[model samples]
Target: MPDNEETLVDVRSLHHRLVRINRVLRLAGSGSGLSAGTAAALWSITQHAPLRLSRLAEIESVSTPAISRIVTSLESMGYVERRADPDDARARLLYPTDAGRDVMSTARNARVLRLAEALDRLEPADRDMVERAFEVLSDALVPPEA
Candidate 1:
């Protein structure tokens, strides 16, 4: 294993690279007219439908009012809707509309295509190395329950 200083240096380099990659991916995937926060909230709603706004705020690490604004934007765009929670009439659940799912699908396809184009430039061995490295990092970073 490397010394602490070496590990820190490598980690910093990895962070920089990941940030750049994320920026590229975000641009590629954001063909939708929605802002980043609004797009992200819609995607999350699609993934975890029938969930409370409070839970979504927690998941997104934003305040309730902030998420509420995003959700309002989404609703205006016809991307998301709120339904009375079956368990509690006082609480409402968020669900993505069909239009919302279509937007997300289109965005996801664009991002995948962009990434695939980049990966295609690499040699087969380098591509394999990237895959292995991604797997290792994902396993290390993700919680066991996740």
Candidate 2:
């Protein structure tokens, strides 16, 4: 069995490598003309449409003001819109625009293609291991509520 310290080191190394891969994928799909944070916020809106700004901030784990700024950018880009909340007249809910969906779809495809190319360069056994590892990591990281 791996010692705790060795496992921790492996985890840290994996985290750094994943971060670098994510950065590369983000850049590869950056033709959508959105900043990383703004694109992430838009993706969140797409996933949970008609959500309140506070709820979005909570999901993104960012300050309300930070989310507000991201939303402002998305709104200006015609990627998202705010509609008055029916239950609460004082609040507005965010939804992705049709254009936003198209852009996000294209961006996702680009990122997937880029990742696929990288994976194709690996040996067959290594590729299989990477796929299984991702499944394990996903199960470990994402809770049932998430």
Best by lDDT: 2
Give each model's whole-structure lDDT: 0.92, 0.94
- Give all candidate RMSDs, comma-separated: 2.0, 2.5
Enumerate residue pairs that collide in model 2.
none
Report the C-alpha lDDT of model 2 over 35-79, residue by residue, as the tens digit.
888889999999999899999999999999999999998999899
Model 2 reaches what TM-score against the true structure? 0.89
Q: How far is candidate 2 from the true structure (C-alpha RMSD, Å)?
A: 2.5
For residues 1-146, could you state the per-residue lDDT of candidate 1 as single tens digits?
45799898998999999999989998999889777788888889999897999999998889999999999989998999999999999999999999999999999999999999999999999999999999999898887883
Pick out the ten consecutive residues of candidate 1 with the lowest summed lDDT: 137-146
Tell me how many residue pairs clash in candidate 2: 0
lDDT score, residue 115, model 1? 97
TM-score, candidate 1, is 0.93
- For all predicted structures, in order, the TM-scores are 0.93, 0.89
